[model samples]
Target: MMRRHPSHLRLKPLAKQVIVITGATSGIGLSTARAAAARGAALVLAARNEDALKAVAEDLSSKGAEVAFVAADVGREADVRAIAAVAVSRFGGFDTWVNNAGVTIVGPAEQTSLDDQRRLFDTNYWGVVYGSLAAIDQFQNQAGGGALINVGAGDVALPLQAAFFASKHAVKGFTDALRTELMAAHAPVSVTLIKPSGADTPGKDNARNLTGAPIAHPAGIYATPLVAQAILYAAEHRTRELTVGSGGRLLALASQVAPALTDPLLAIGARLNARIAKAPDPARIDNLHHAGRDLRERSFQPGVRETSLYATAQMKPKTTLGLMAAAALAAGFAFKLGARKAAPIDE
Candidate 1:
């Protein structure tokens, strides 16, 4: 069993807190930055692109937000430390640090080169490690401690993106272990692992696609803001983990309940993913080796869900569960009545 802290923890409100977010130039990171700023939070943003970071800082600053940015890659320890240094220099210190910087490779695990796999780990896994340590050190010395939020994917592994899935699994392990250590020591920090489902972010477009075809998320995709909301909620509240969409929660459940059935379904989904691509881009550029240039948050995918009832349930479990159970019972009763009516009269 995991140990619990002896003391009560208190986190600051968004308007009065200083938040540091890595990978702030685009996607969920950018969306989180925007939402935090809107809530009157002072922001410290980090990303590989200096120009894009500057542009984001300026835009947020124009709206009367106290925003600072550092151009640092989280994969490097020194660079990750620099992000903390700027946060201290600009706003005294940060209340929440989000390790959201990551890159993906869309191809078979065997076909992926050893060098490419290492590079992906450098950004995805090592990046989270470095940021988590940095945030822990700062929080340990501070009065209120802090929130450490790591953006991870759904727990289930996908067929085409093995490397990415492996990295996420590593992140989940690290985050959980760190949370346990913090609790044992009676630390005030709140560590949260955010497992989002297929989000309509630019990640697919930014991925290193070696399959010679356009790639897309194989499952239901939710809007970036849904994930941003979860991140921000973790910033203010203490939660062990939060899944952003119902699809992610369902996949996790299925994987545990029926792995034998789930494996074949995932394989079918992988093949369907390739077929669903409208066309392949001949000049597509991936950010696996370099800084991403695009700053757009949304992928503009059709059928993007704007909200998630499952996500709401994660934040408020008892009430949502009660509502969901009642709805399920009603549906089951209706189905039973319909089946009885359709029975043969001779019976």
Candidate 2:
């Protein structure tokens, strides 16, 4: 029972418009699926897990959602084509497509294998590429413009997640190019890039299944319900870029105005993270998804503080800073407690 305020409900995009959502088995995609169903939109859910997809479709159907689902590894072209086929066969045709299925392997580039990194790109980056092509085809045939919503992240240059960040950076550049081309030629397809911060969802738990480990960062920062509400609003508004998390949007803004300063700031973060990092065995696949879940810790939003330029001088006093640092050490130890049990997945 996810209860939303009246304002949170999206307008039913007319029965003429069908929508397809990838990564719909969980997380942001799952939340969006539920929201879209609530709005009376015909739906198509895509994910690699067949059982999970079926379950989601059934749940939505019980709620009177005109939903169908397909299980496919988005990394493959034929599979993605089949996903679009499922949408067409079940719902007639699609008016919107969301590229939301993704994966992340977080660690130093040196320790992460090129093979594994490429696999991540195959899904995170290429998966979206395939979706856009399909959507463009449908929109071109349908007359007016339809939307393609892409899932992105705030940390385009974060050090710890080379593959993940690289895929997102590629999405940023790809969307830019796609939007430009559409505008230049007057193509009837619209693109929206969604950059959201840590969404509290099934992403980390699912990633653990792939890498057989846990993430090196806390997952609760996402405020999933809030982000989900934002996505629906973005769709109705046809927003070009939507940064949901307040802190995350600020970080993105700072990165733009002062690249030189932000570079060093991240460099400092990387160094601190590395120095404090307890390296997992590079060879351990059975326990190698996201760093054993010991990365859990809460980060305050710090409120609407002064600009980043003024942030350094305004930091907490040295005595308090030292005490906070000591607490971080203790919190880091408490992180180990979160690894108490493995996440259960039907797959």
Candidate 3:
């Protein structure tokens, strides 16, 4: 079980919240469903896999969770809309909508075909777009305000998965813009972007593999439950953004502070990490063309990180910011000292 932050205890009970989760058949989405179910929240699960969806829904329902399943592809706007319809028709209007359905491709940018790139965006980018719109419309029409949570990446770029990273960047930008609009209108809607780093999930295995070499999740990966914690947190409390994993936070920070240096480092790290974490080929049955292959709640690998720094950061933002500021200052001082020592002596 993942550790819950102090703030998590402060949020109102989720017993009455009608929560809608896309891609709920596996990974973080399925984990979030389990978390929310434990909290007594009514749920509507959406995914392309009918059998997997039914199995999850039944399992949750048997466990006393008010859960229902909708077999729909998030890539299609109509399917996304249908998901919302199911949420309302079954559990009443959903109080939170999680746009977590996404897919990625593994390969160099140039090597990835335009068709594959476009298809990736269709699920990763367009899926969030459609789900967000539907949730926004529902929230605007309803009496009570609602939360719209979209899962993005901590680092805007990930080596070897250029198209996937680009789509995540798009999601971040789109969500930021939508939040601005909501604030400007004084809308009672909370738009949150959850940025999780690599987690032990079947996502890596399910991604379309264009790379001839085997790929795997890097070391220091976090468990999927940590992300589920963030998702459930967002479902209750309003947050602008929450980034999961310390490694992810560090990479995001480095990218922001020193992009030129960080890019090359990330490229090298990504390549080396993949090579080190190579896994046996599961027949390379990628989910680019469709879904339903590796239906799993967690990946085969056990994530190293036990607790989430993201959760702690979310609860104590000011303290975390102060610590980050101190670290930055210390690093700056060290760099200055190094430069001064390297300078030629006047004598």
Candidate 4:
């Protein structure tokens, strides 16, 4: 059983808050940093690339945002601690911490190297563990509790990215367990998990590709900023989890309601992914073992959706649920009326 907090918990507005974001050099983290800074929040950015971190910090600072950068790898517990330490030293303490560093391998589970898989877990799973612990500890000592945001992939797992999906599953489990423990302790902290579908981010480009050909999500690619919006929303709101795309939510629902059918469809989708024809670049340096050079938020994928109604609904669940219920009632009434009209007059 979990106990509620003794009193109401209030989160600071964006302009008055300080945020710490790991993996801030690219993808959702970079986009979130920009969004938060634009909203007048001071930021502490962390990533493996000191130069790129400096560039991002300089850019945000030049725009009149209070920003700091730390070149720390989240895979190492000590380095993760250093990130929190910098937030404490620079901004007195961070109001939110976003664990957004992750890496993936594109291939069959058997084809990928064990070392690579372990390394991916190091950054994805263990990194979240370290960041969550550090943030929780800091929040306990602070005046008001803070938010911990863990970025996870969609709930439905895909074929080629087995290890990556497994890491995300672990992240979800750990986050849930931690949230329960915090509630049991009556702690004034919010833990949120951000589940994003295929997004047009450098992650796919930076992934280790053991497959002979390139790999991408089969469908439903969303813009990186959309995911950033979800993350920032979680920071200010006490959301348990937010799936960034409707496609992802539907797939997750399908898998839960009918895995037998969904499994075969996923297997067929795997075949289509294998036939994409694009070859992996021999010279491209994958970010699994090192930092990626490309720091941009968006990838080259076209037709990236800029918005998600499902994501918007998640932010306002009660109203959305009421609207959905009303629509269902109206549809049922219309169906009955049409059925009566089509029936013969002699009852």
- Those runs of model 4 whose alpha carbons end farther than 4 Å from true positions after fitting are 1-7, 277-281, 318-347
Score candidate 3 by lDDT: 0.83
lDDT by residue for model 3 (1-347), tens: 12222222222458979899998988889889999999999999999889888888889899998888899999999999999998888866888999998887888889999999998898889999999999988877776668899999876577888898899999999999998887766667888899887777888778877776667777888888889998888888888898888788888788899899988987787768557666657675777878755557677675457688766788578999999999999999999999999999988
What C-alpha lDDT, on a 0 to 100 scale, does residue 36 get in candidate 3? 95
After superposition, candidate 3 runs with Cα above 4 Å error: 1-12, 316-347
Candidate 1: segments with Cα more than 4 A from true spot: 1-7, 321-347
Task: Report the poorest 10 consecutive residues by lDDT, candidate 4.
Answer: 1-10
As a whole number from 0 to 100, the lDDT of residue 54 in candidate 3 is 88
Candidate 2 yields a Cα-based lDDT of 0.66
- Of candidates 2 and 1, the better by TM-score: 1
Could you tell me which residue pairs clash in candidate 1? Answer: none
Candidate 2 pairs with clashing backbones: 198-222, 211-289, 213-289, 214-290
TM-score of each: 0.91, 0.71, 0.86, 0.91
On a 0 to 1 TM-score scale, where does candidate 2 land against the true structure?
0.71
Quick one: ranking by lDDT, best first? 1, 4, 3, 2
The CA lDDT at 2 in model 4 is 26
lDDT of 1: 0.90
Off by over 4 Å in 2: 1-16, 208-220, 256-347
Give me the overall lDDT of model 4.
0.89
Give the lDDT of residue 133 in candidate 4: 94
